[model samples]
Target chain A: MTDNATRDIEELIGMMARLPGLGPRSARRAVLHLIKKRALLMMPLAEAMQQVAATARECLACGNIGTSDICDICSSEKRATGEICVVEDVADLWAMERGASFRGRYHVLGGTLSALDAIGPEELRIPKLLDRVRAEGVTEVILALNATVDGQTTAHYIAEQLEGTGVSVTSLAQGVPIGGELDYLDDGTITAALKARKRF
Target chain B: MTDNATRDIEELIGMMARLPGLGPRSARRAVLHLIKKRALLMMPLAEAMQQVAATARECLACGNIGTSDICDICSSEKRATGEICVVEDVADLWAMERGASFRGRYHVLGGTLSALDAIGPEELRIPKLLDRVRAEGVTEVILALNATVDGQTTAHYIAEQLEGTGVSVTSLAQGVPIGGELDYLDDGTITAALKARKRF
Candidate 1:
């Protein structure tokens, strides 16, 4: 008789392979691992996954995921930094959090303005960002957009839109970073280079 | 007013840092990316995480994670190879699965027998494996233990226990792996060296 266990495991492997960075080989490995550590790692992981699924939702205002309409950051009274750091995606937001330095609220742009793809400001929540800036009396808007062509185009457009709003526009520093050597720095970097410029 | 957003983000960052292979720096970067892509990647990932946390459960028999008591693998009759490839943990089992050649049942030993650690046969699934062999009419037992000292000891002990049980035991073949060279072979490998190795 055909083995049902094999089919079932194969299905699980297929699902796991769909995850980012995991292929069929990795998925199979992961599944086997979970089975072996059922009591310690797998069981707990399953429980946690279930709990999160039941309670997680997107924050309506900022699009952050949490268990409520407003995530902890949005609901907290202390987070009103009077400035919003705007970015294109959640991955970028995660990167910023890794830095652990910023002290401001955020505005996730969802995606860049792509004319060819028909993605515009309306699709990217630009209107919502403008509303937050006006309502919150934000004095600065950090354009933490990617260094891609599309990202720059979107940034310049947003800057133009916010020009007369009395808010200062800024970005992450340019040039070789900490632990970066000057010889490795590219020609394009030298052009956008920020002088050892002063205080924010 | 104090910046509540920063504090909340920082707390989130702390939690993210505890994930496997991610440090504080990567966690910060991840958080920033999430903030930027809040509407797309971050929100969806959060939702998916929550859903999985709530629904994940371990298979009662095989320890595979699923929504029900018995994992799909254990319940499937097709996987009854009457051959259980024994492993030390789930991760190891997964690694074998990634190879995708074997099509037999599995028995996770959980851990190896260790005299120093006060671990005995009872601590592992040795008795359970014996019972399974009798119950399931298993013919071959593959000792897929690790190459570690404890792993070898456990394999030998299991072999002794199964003496006269009429089951053939086979260990994984060792040699220069696919695309591996004889010069890269370690001492153990050079010793286990077969006079006439089979060509795959």
Candidate 2:
């Protein structure tokens, strides 16, 4: 390749490398794969990206991303169960949807409170969530945040914010994960699981 | 977001998941990241992919991909060294270029011979490589093929074909990789490195 062509391809690879779960090496591999399957994969991917780029937007109600002002979960009448699942980001919300257990709605916080990063409740959708609780007559708020310290701190802050909102607040149980081996369980997880053991 | 909007986003995510090194989970995260940085990252990526899709083509001379009929490496005077590195795919050629060591041109074979898959010498650029060796006055043909069974078989076949062509055929050495820990070394790699031990 000439310098110009090589540079173009390299720039593409560099952008791809910035994506989550991909490194420079894997990005290069992906570019090659795209090139090899240009007709079948690359062209379609480019068109899809263009379409999404032109259409994708955040849900005004819940902060979930879609091709409209309101996300599917937020707009669906079937999900109007007066329950809101709070998550740190859209990825967590998508994970919850994949589980197919949550029949209500979701609120994507964008990120959690981080003292080092100077992030606060105001930086997230906390205020919007409170408004939704009152306006939508939400009866429950499920905190599905990660088990990290910052995640818990954000959950506690949100719970405190909703103290006088007349809504039930619950968090996911901390215990041995399904399919987890006892040998690989951490001390904290093992302790939590033991303490929360059921009558079974 | 209605069903139509959800379908659009889901379609994009499905296309992304088909790319190499990206699973359904990583694709979801990547889509979210792209949506988050739509103006800065996603739009440029979409444009770049579109440009590459429109203009990228294979070089008629050495089979390397470029925007022109002849690839940059093939047309460059500086890279006109008598050595011609042979690789099974464009990705290997790109990898060699990234190392910034090889100054010669390359011949991409597209793929190796796989009898089970019914692939033969005619399926690759073996004939064109021989023609280039004579036409371009190539002195050395470096076989940078993968170390798979099919790759080695293809290498040996190419070497045998070039026996009387006055071209030196060579393959990459098999041994321990740089920065690789001995504890993590596989048995085959350890044996090969021991057999090919050289003066330190």
Candidate 3:
């Protein structure tokens, strides 16, 4: 290969290494695999990425990512069930959708509140979430944030903000995960599960 | 997201999951990371992959993957040192290059001989390597094949084929690996290391 061509291969590997789960060694392996399956995978992946890049947009009403100004959940009449599930990111919203349990729409906060990072309600979609609750006549707002300190802090702040809005504020139940071993369960999770034990 | 948009995202994730080191979960994380940094990573990765897919080709003489008919090492004057390090694949050749100890060109076999799979000398770059040895006045044919059964079998076959070609054939020294503990060494490796013991 020429110098320029070699550089291009290296550049691709470098970009792949920047992904969340991949490192330099795996990046090289992946680049080789892509090169080996060029027509079948590499080209198609490139086209797909470009297609998404060109069309993907954040929803106007919620912070959900989609291909239109208003995301599918926000636009779908069936999803306006007077309840909204709040999440920290689009990945979390997708995870909830995958469960197929909740029929309500979602509000993506983009991130949690971080005092040291100088992130406040303004930095997140807190104001937009508040507006959506009132504008859409949402009867309940579910805080599905992570159990981390920052996540709980942000959830509490949102709940306090919605205290007078007539919408009931709820959060996901904390317990040992389904199929979890009691011996392996953490102290906090065991305590929570025990405190919230259900009656047969 | 709409069905079509959701399908696009899923399609991309599926393709990513097909890569060597990534699974469905890691692919989702990677895709999300790419989407989050669309301008910085996703678009650039797509463009780079497309560029490589369009340009990458197998070196006609050595079977190395590159952008031209002949790979960089095959075409470089400095690399034509009358010695060719034979590796099982381009990845192995790349590993050698990264080590930077070899000053000669390389011959990538593409794969090893496997009777169960019906692979033979013609299935690899054996013929091209033979022709190169004669044309390039190669003094040494270094077999850098893996220690696996198939790799060793292929190396022996190549060494036998070059018996009367006036070229010296050699294999890499087998010993305890760098930073490897003797206590953790496997039996075969330990035996090989002992058999090949040298003066300090």
Top lDDT model: 3
Clash number for each model: 55, 2, 2
Question: lDDT by residue for model 1 over B1-200, one digit each (tens)?
Answer: 12445445566656545444446776566555555555555545544443444455555565445567766556678778877898887667767877988888778787999999999999988898888787888999999999899999999999998889998888887666787788888878866767436686
Q: lDDT values of the candidates?
A: 0.71, 0.89, 0.91
Q: After superposing candidate 3 on the true structure, give the runs of residues whose Cα lies further than 4 Å from its correct spot.
A: B115-118, B180-190
Candidate 3 global lDDT:
0.91
What tens digits encode model 2's per-residue C-alpha lDDT throughout A1-200?
45566678888999999999899999988988888788898888988888888888888999888766877777789999999999999889878888988899999998999989998879999999998998999999999999999999999999999998889999999998889999999999999999999998
The stretch of ten residues in a row with the least summed lDDT in candidate 3 chain B is: B1-10
Best-first order by lDDT: 3, 2, 1
- DockQ (Cα-based) for each candidate: 0.11, 0.64, 0.69
Per-residue lDDT of model 3, residues A68-126, tens digit only? 78888988999889989999998899899889999999999999999999999999999
Ranking by DockQ: 3, 2, 1
Instruction: Give the lDDT of residue A48 in candidate 3.
Output: 96
Kept native contacts, fraction for each prediction: 0.05, 0.70, 0.77
Q: What TM-score does each of the candidates earn?
A: 0.61, 0.91, 0.92
RMSD per prediction, one decimal?
6.6, 2.4, 2.3
